[model samples]
Target: MTKINAFTYQPLTIPSHTESVSKQNQKPNAQKSSFSESLEEEYEKLPLKLSKHARERIDERDIHISQTEWNLIHSKMQEAKKMGINDSLVLTKDAALVVNMPNQTVITAMGLEEANTRIFSNINGTIVINH
Candidate 1:
């Protein structure tokens, strides 16, 4: 009968001297560009994400927002984040959205009519889109 151990451990291997030297010699700009490229790729993957509550509200309230409008909202949200706005109220022709700028998430949404009757709190900025 052969006995087997339940766990196995592997020793950590340190980088060879030449490997460390090559890494130290790499251009800083090249490293920065690669990191920035990866960040851009991640940003592109999720331009916007709607929370479950936001989606529910959108469907329940029958709000219609076009893709172009969403793109514009996303760009504006990025600008708002740069300006240190974490929570924002976005007013559009047909709908209103509360967005978390840093996370690029729509927290909730409502029709323009409903939005007009309600008070929005904890919002640092507002973006009004005519289109």
Candidate 2:
């Protein structure tokens, strides 16, 4: 998109040499490198330690859930398996505990429908599991 001035002088008349080593030796402009260019070209390159330290930090923050919560989560997981449902499964209701069990929350927050199924029961009051 360069705009050429009509008043500029004519093009150079020298026959261009394709194999000239002197022409090849000319340095490229440093500012126009691709987005994925290596950082070695500038002072802004990430230090080698940064990536290693980030991975170590992530490893340290890996968390484990309580056993009781884990059991509930596992049971819900099995139900999903039985239904042959994937992450895209749709639920008709909002999975919520507002009045009596507001303190309880869905163990695994996957899909919206799965969340509803995990929190809701047809029978009200305390859940009575026969198993």
Per-candidate clash tally: 0, 0
The CA lDDT at 8 in model 2 is: 55
Candidate 1, residues 86-119, lDDT tens digits: the string is: 9999999999999998888999999988888999
Question: lDDT per residue, candidate 2, 1-131, as tens digits?
Answer: 33477555566566567458455644353333442255323212211111333233323433222344335533543454455433222121222111112212222223233344464433233221122
Q: Any idea how many clashes model 1 has?
A: 0
Worst 10 residues of 2 by lDDT: 95-104
- TM-scores, each model vs. reference: 0.64, 0.21
Each prediction's RMSD to truth? 12.3, 17.3
What RMSD value applies to candidate 1?
12.3
In candidate 1, stretches whose alpha carbon ends up further than 4 angstroms from where it belongs are 1-46
